[model samples]
Target: MNRSSSSRAGLALIGVTSLVLAATGAPASAAPALTMTLSSTTGPGGGATIVGSVTANSVTPVPFPAGTNPTVQFQYVGTTAASSACSASAKVVSPIVVSNLLTTAGTLTVNPAAVKRISTTKIVFQVPSSPYPVNDANGNPSTVNPNGLVLMGGQTSSRWSVCVYDSDNVTTSTLLATATYTLAIKPTITSILPASSPAGGGQTITVNGTGFAATSVATTATAGGVALTNVKVAANGNSFTATTGPRAAGDGLPVVVNAPGGTVSSLDPDNNSQTNDPPIPFSYTNGISITPNQAAAGTQVTIDVIGAGFSSLTFDAGAAPIGSGAHVFLVKDAYVANSNRGVAECTGVSVIRDTELICTLDLAADQLNPANSATMPGVAIAEGAYVLTVVADGGTGAGGSANPTIVSSGATFTVGPY
Candidate 1:
């Protein structure tokens, strides 16, 4: 080959190399140049921190707002979207823009702006409410909670990961690992309805709060040490209703709830100054009783029963072992015939929560007769002083037993003819 031809070929080769270098584009750049350090990362329910410094990606370097750090962005995103386009409105955090080079550690603050919900997964900083109104989805704008990170309604996505990005940008490509902390939202109880109930503990109660889940198997509601029954959490993950179990008389008993977000106690930790009771307390009544314990053998006598712990009975639901109303009876010991120890049943007995009811004792003379009673079977109901006992009949079921009959003071009554 001639020297001139070889020179032309070398020039051609150099031209091809230049084009290839331009096409490759800075060696494919590099992953986000930021490291995140966080505390609450794995589980739900609890505050956490995010901190780190931002450096330019090896290839195309984007400056960090010139000299000021301004603010960092936080977002909840599905694992798949971590490196994909995340919306501006998805900023569930409000971290401060402390430094440009250091990017300092940030503490989480709870925004007291009424916890308005724009969506289930994010907090929107808008006009008059937050200092930075640049985070709505309409247009990619500026900082959120420009001063510090403000946490609101605990709606941290259960399936999404909490992520941090440099500056006010939540862009997928700009996802800088500023910190590795979890903002998974701890559960909180705000209020309880019908705060007081009878010591016997059979009342329906409503609990209002955030970070609760209806579908979570771990959710529970408890008062004192007894577990509340029939707990139903609302679909919104904000509240639940349950029936209280019987508890001894007390003031300000704590009602603890455990849910997917974590555990929360009704006892107000900040208000422990109340020496007598908890701020969010449940009180139990001292006792339960009935009035007008005596009645005639053939006539109806009205009786009044009163006390706390009276829960609305759901007979068909089998919610409790006892049924509605009170049953009256006299033990076999009250029978004139010693051998006839069967209990004397009352007729027309009605019962309810602290309600009024009339009872009748209509035992036939033959049934009550104690003489020659060994040969024939009959309940003994005779003229004598006796105590009337009360029982409830919710009936028994598989692997369950009926409730026990109760005897209390003011239950003494004499059976006499009118």
Candidate 2:
């Protein structure tokens, strides 16, 4: 008979069998035994949704035994290739029973309560919340935190045989899926050579720092309210050298070093920590100079000093010379008096030639006055005679003083139309 015809005939037989089984005591031998099948499983933590069907050949409505609690136990058998057995055993994830098989000729619907369906045929069977530690196919403990499904047994059996369902049928559980991650750390800056120098275009500064890779480092300089450019890192990746481009003279440009990764923590020359915990600070040496012993009134003179440590250099006129030294004045124009009106100016400066300080000056108004320019320009006779001061306002030097040896007694220069 055709499928439809067969189904109709089966229903008729089911009715007759039901009546007979209800009346007669001869346990209806014609009734077929119900069977279950598992379709699919899913979700994290080894949770699985199983799809199964209850089938019997007889037309009698096979009422699945009551109190029949069917449970799915998952054993974490070692990988198939593993020589030893899985240390962790399996436990019942989800327990269910065949509720009601309405018909024997058609598909039997298993209610949601009977089997939690994850998808069409895919059902998610609840697994233990605790992770199962098992060995992988390679004999290694599954490093995948909570290893998932392990297919054991049930190879030939219709993906749903009770014979295959039991633990006896299972040989070893095969790992199915796992979870996927990266590691990171911090960076630092160490030391900068030539800690002090004159500011302006042409100063080659070296910045040192660890963990510097490729173009991961940079340096910047700001002096006299101006920002310099062309910051670059060395090829070695440990140092960064660059020249100050067009900055005002006597400007103590604060050089900032930025490196890949993070902040640096190393002992500097002064034993100070370059880490800059309390104060993120760095040090650099520059090569520049300030000069001149004596000058006539209204003379535009350029002070030339040479040395390193010019990175963060500040200049002040009211600042005192070396020792109980004389007071230095920063003149504006060639007409200013010896008045304490010492205007602090940072201009016409360049880091020309190595680390040399190049600055231009316009004589003060009353510079020729007896109390001013009239008196001989106090000669800086010794090497340490001239010093670079880096104070907020007439403050002390940041990198101390550089004493240069004075070779000449005194040189004369005209400042005005005498």
- The digit string of per-residue lDDT tens for model 2 on 1-418 reads 8999999999999999999888877743323223334342221222333344444334524323333323333332211212212112222232212223211110111122433433222233443332333445588864432333222232110111111121211333211111110000123445545543343345555656543434312334332333435656555555556565533243233444333322333322222354334322332222223456335454556766443333344443332222212223343222112232123222355544433455554454322221222323443211122223222222223432222211111211223333
Q: Give TM-scores for every candidate, taking all chains together and pairing residue i with residue i.
A: 0.36, 0.29
Best by lDDT: 1
Residues 48-93, model 1: lDDT tens digits? 2222333445542543433332233333333223332333322544
TM-score, candidate 2, is 0.29
lDDT (C-alpha) at residue 277 in model 2: 47
Ten-residue segment with the worst summed lDDT in candidate 2? 176-185
As for model 1, its CA RMSD to the true structure in angstroms is 15.2
